[model samples]
Target: MSTHTPGEDVPVRRIDRILAFMSLGLLVLSIVCFFAIMIGSASGADMSGGVWPLIGVVVYIAPIVAFALMLAVLIMSFVRRARANRGG
Candidate 1:
């Protein structure tokens, strides 16, 4: 009773793809920042100095925000596809 045939590819929206890419980029940046912070700390750099801690906080938070956005985009895409399939 399915409209789609077996082995058919499901189409993804452009916005969803863009959000996914953005999320991935944010995750990569977060990881790089984490390593940089660790190395800096190990090298006796003052984390509390000037803007370092602020940079650290923003980097740590970026992935969470990016992932949330990506999740929203994915859910919206899924709902839109479902509605379309239902002939709404």
Candidate 2:
């Protein structure tokens, strides 16, 4: 290990499991909404002929993407820690 002190640049932190869990839940919900809207658009009703459906899709994607990105960061952090422990 180089002579760099841990707290100098990378500060110690706590992993908020509750926040992680909530993010995962939101991500799942958004994904479900995305698919639901997509299918509904493809099917009958033909609401607004399509404009409204596209708009709905955009609205749903934001939250889901945000949650997914947060999850990815958590996963990556875990993997990195594991690798460090194993001297990889």
Candidate 3:
């Protein structure tokens, strides 16, 4: 029989979980903003003619930032796993 305890199977770190939640939140926000921009443009709401357009640009960048954060978390998790395997 396996000797591992229940708690020992949890491989994800707390920080990783936090980062994941943050990434999810950013994804949701990006989706909402995308739809908003699409609907606004379709309705001839001047999406590209005012301050709202600047806000749209910021919203568009959120997913990119989220991706970078997730990539960092993945790299960190890999490094952690490697160190653990090395018995350090």
TM-scores of the models, in the given order? 0.78, 0.41, 0.75
Sorted by lDDT, highest first, which candidate order results?
1, 3, 2
RMSD of 1: 2.6
Question: What is the per-residue lDDT of model 2 for residues 1-88, given as tens digits with 9 covering 90 to 100?
Answer: 7664433332224454555666777667666767766777688656666565665765577686666767776776666666655556
Question: What value does the lDDT take at residue 82 in candidate 3?
Answer: 69
Q: Show pairs that collide, candidate 1.
A: none
What C-alpha root-mean-square deviation, in Å, does candidate 2 show against the real structure? 8.2
- Candidate 1 off by > 4 Å: 1-10
- Each prediction's Cα lDDT score? 0.80, 0.62, 0.79
Top-TM-score candidate index? 1
Off by over 4 Å in 3: 1-10, 48-51
lDDT of 3 at 13: 83
Residue-level lDDT of model 3, residues 31-85, one tens digit each, is: 8888887788788886657767766876878899899889989898878876765
Sort order, TM-score high to low: 1, 3, 2
